[model samples]
Target chain A: MEQWKKQWTPLLPERVAEILERLPDDAPLLEIRLRCDRPLELVFDGSDRIVYGNNKAPIVEENELKALLRRLTGYSAFAWENERKSGFITVGGCRVGLSGRMIRTEDGVLGFSTVSGVCIRIVREVKDCAKPLLPYLLCGGRFRSVLLVSPPGCGKTTLLRDMIRIASDGLYGAVPCRVGVADERFELSGDANGAIAFDLGTRTDVISGISKSDAAVRIVSTLSPGILAMDELNDANDAKAVSEARGKGVAVFATAHGADGKDLRLRPAIGALLDAHVFERIALLEGVGRLTSVTDGDGLRVDAVSQ
Target chain B: MKTIGIALLFALCCLAGVRLGAKKAAPLKMIRAMRAGLQSFSDRTASGATLADAAEPADDAFRERLSVYLESLSQGSAQADAAGRASAAFGASDAVRSGAELFFCGLSDAPRAELQRRIEAFGAVLARAEVDAENESKQARVLRSAGFLVGTGLAVLLL
Candidate 1:
């Protein structure tokens, strides 16, 4: 723990630490907003979602966020989770939601490229973020495959990262599962110096620098991990891999981008994944990192009791 | 001794006449030669001919005349070496001695009439050198006189 503390302390800038320190203790995650002349707005929901902003906001897109994560983490490949409407990185368990550009692909209409105004909602986990959602996630002493959905800048990834951490650390009532993270990008751990700067969990096996689809297949078959965490399941290959992982009884945690329930179905990739019935839960994150909606695998809305 | 004095006097007179003539003619002759040399070199270079191939019969005549003139100057004074005589006759100073030698050598096989004309021109220039030296001294005296006049006028005005 001391070694980890020493390792991570140098990796994080003083400004980032100051921002992290300003976060609310009760909040699952904290947001640090950057604006010109506008006071930094830090918003923390009781869940593992946080939103930081200023009044004069810069436009951020799903591709832009993916590019940022790629630059920040030096990940090789990036893709938009067209089916779930999210942005995926090849680094850590970091999934970011993107808001602009929907183009046509051979596999139908997936968010092809990002242009103009866009917002990237970066997902991460705080210790207390997954406390409420953990119980429902672990049913009959086993994990269920879940798909987190959110609009741009929502806390789907933050919630998912926390869920994975909690599950791996055995914070919830369930046993500590070997969480295999196909972090195509380094958003979750934001790893520097080959070590995870940010904590995912003790037992989580993070495989960075590979496609989510490929990592999913490898982890399910070879690693035989208890839970597979991947970000931004966009393409048909990604959907197929996730379905295959679920078929082998390996619980999968994934995120996607969308405005609402209706908009999610409009996405061709997400629509197909839904048809395939790969996920048991479709958790919808909304407004400033709030879990506004939660639905079961059948697309039926379920009430989430506020923490 | 009297014969030697008479010869010396005659030589001085001859030297003065040649020098006077050279003062007027040497510059023109040098200019003409330079122009001719440049034209010849250009013609040869353009025509893709070697120096030997480019040497016309008239050029050979000029070289023969220059050599005879140099030989005559060499006969007048043992004090003047072959090199000095060659320089005076052919306008081939130490810097261009090799070129002068090559020119004369080319003419060794040419006709005698053309060679005599070249010799006369060379002798005339060599004889004029003493007179040109004397004229130069006279010009320096004139310049000094002019400078002294100007200085005296300035001193008088200041007083």
Candidate 2:
């Protein structure tokens, strides 16, 4: 078998380009999908370094490659060594599953050691995936709270970001309203140096590096923004903040990782929000970026074709 | 020899004291001038006064000096505008076009000096704006606090 470095090195640029280029042409109009929805397994040592996996084996020495991997993941004290063979860090929102030596304790599995290999999956964000649903959202001349649901790497955040840009650009109607994005992770803006590089819009106010709940309150009260956006809604505090924003009449767009609408409705805080009718539309993304189904408050299917 | 070394040290200390004193005085003077300039600008702009209105009260000699400066600025702006339009029309890259446009549009001689000077002036304006915003918010807080105190007092008296 070819060495991991030899196989991956030549294909790295091509793979990156493919991810960026394969974005749905009718993004915002169609659902942007991920090619692999399954979580990729990542094997690492206690130091969070990549071990090895897939075609790659014979993991690199920790001393020589650990520093490089640290720079990539931005997290220290984590290392992966799969079966003491090969390893590399995965990019974007792709899952990195663990393997190798298991350190089991009475409480639970403490950690993995003597790592073997890892599987790196690529996650891509296609633009304009939500374009078809824009009219339905803005049908009443007022924006509604939208909840986008999908499993991991399903392009929920990508759809949300485009929707924001669209709303800010006023692509559907008048001048874009003020949008406040509470991006806890640097995913939406992809800003490394604490400033938004892209033109989200003149009216967009981005407060990166803060919890969604805190950002929502700050934007709503201080910025007096019209719309609020966030990704990975998990906590009760986040739900509470969303509820408060809804009460204040601010439109919200958020995404979460879930298998289906029913699965989404089962989450504690998420279920509460749904029960309270926090979101006007629940869009279910499936099979990568395909929009499998969309439902209204009554759980009735809305057969709106996306462009 | 020890006596000589002590004397030399004293002389060095005296020299250092003089140098430090001079350095401190210069910065203090600059700070005072900056404060005075800010105050003058604020006073002129206050009470519904425009830049033109403020300039009107100056002596004829000052007005003549101002006119010459304004004329030079206008000519510079004209040249800049021509360059900017040409670059834009030629469909140059964004970097080139923006650089040309900013050179002519953002640096027009109305504010005086060259591009670098205008940028410095803009920085000062931004600083002043921040300070003004801070002061306004502070004043609002004071007013709110006073209102709260009065309301509490009134409520106590009514009870």
Candidate 3:
């Protein structure tokens, strides 16, 4: 087996861990999405490929999910209160999304009352996945603000990550720009314990475990990055923050979840950002090897970056 | 020689009675300390302290048990495993032992209020432990004093 595949070892319960290890070597294990009481299925080889780990496929219990979270957060329930409330946390570069009943008070959401499910999205950095799309994202010899669009699980994160690395380390005919990553979920940067587990490249700054909206504005003022990269802009506050940063002339490389270019224009938040000209280029991410539809700031489908 | 021997036995009897009394009383002190530790834990948890950093500096024995529990957790041990290990290391009765486990086990994906509540409930466990320890200690105290007196009376009668 390749050494790179070993890095995807999720901190699963012992029973599931043993089952994962027994998977056939030829199995193209892309992601392992687990939910409480749901049968464990492996995503690989296709858009929705499923591989059975066990004939009985042990049901994931609430206790098991709690155990997993305890292990992932190093048992720091207090420190992870916000993430727990938000229903998502990143551990070892994988985004662990959770589902639970929201516990709110007079002010706002306090935390979760009862945790129910967990989906561990394994982040695989597909190096050079941006090679074809890099041209559309660059104009002449400098970076342009590009927003990656895709429905959830369509490889937007994987592509956006590679693009950031390329822009930070320098790509073909383009100089290495000072890149700042606002990694709210720790998915893009893969940084933990003051040590970067993933090689983003030389001269890349990442701020994790903060709201992307805050990080977007702060990274510009503090890091003064030539290009600001982030993932999943959702809501008016995030759009407002990114627009203000782009107004400062710092090119923003970010992503959003949507079906297509039409969906981008339909979404109220993206429409607001587009009207302000925050994004110069928008690329729609599809399955692996599929072309990414590149559109101009006006949401017009201009060209397709071939895979 | 006989007079000296009687005096020595009497002194030994008195010392044994005192030791028994101290044994009976020591658990109450430990129980109070545990209660204090629970309050600190509640305060710390309410302040959003991380499990690794939430150390309530109580008595030496309590702190030692907490360190073992948190260290095991920090080292990536499962909740039950870490809690069980800490409980096993505790030199106390079932109530205190299970209380230690409950303390660590409650550090799940729970909110500050829930965790604080868990610590609040720990007081009952400490109270129960104190009662059990006190009962054993009281039995020992009675046995020591009464047995010494009975032996001494029998000795005098035999002489």
lDDT of 2 at A262: 82
Ranking by DockQ: 3, 2, 1
- Docking quality band of candidate 1, CAPRI definitions: incorrect
Candidate 3, superposed: residue stretches over 4 Å from native: A1-10, A24-27, A45-58, A299-307, B1-67, B70-84, B87-102, B113-159
lDDT for predicted candidate 1 compared with the true structure: 0.54
What lDDT would candidate 2 get against the real structure?
Answer: 0.53
lDDT per residue as tens, model 1, A55-170? 53433333333334333232111111322233332223333333346677697755435433222233444567766665556776566788888765666666777888887887
Best by TM-score: 3
The runs of at least 3 residues in candidate 1 whose Cα sits more than 4 Å from the true structure, single-residue gaps closed, are A1-125, A303-307, B1-159
lDDT of 1 at A73: 31
Q: Which residue pairs does candidate 3 place in steric collision?
A: none
CA RMSD (A), model 1: 32.3
**Model 3 chain A: lowest-lDDT 10 consecutive positions:** A1-10
Candidate 3 lDDT by residue in tens digits, A6-101? 644456876667666776765655667666777776676464534343575555777777777777776667667887778876777787787878
TM-score of every model versus the real structure:
0.44, 0.48, 0.71
Q: What DockQ, on C-alphas, does every prediction get? A: 0.01, 0.01, 0.34
The list of candidate 2 runs beyond 4 A from truth reads A1-56, A59-61, A73-125, A303-307, B1-159
**Deviation from native of the Cα of residue A143 in model 1, angstroms:** 1.7
Residues B1-159 of candidate 3 have per-residue lDDT tens digits of 877777677667667776767776677777777667667766665665555445655556666777787788657677689789877876566767877778667565555666766676667787788788778777777867775786587458646
State which candidate, 1 or 3, has the greater DockQ.
Answer: 3
Q: Which candidate leads the pack in lDDT?
A: 3
For B56-157, candidate 1 gives per-residue lDDT tens digits of 422443434344533443243221243344444545333334344433442322223333354344344433543554555566555455545554454455
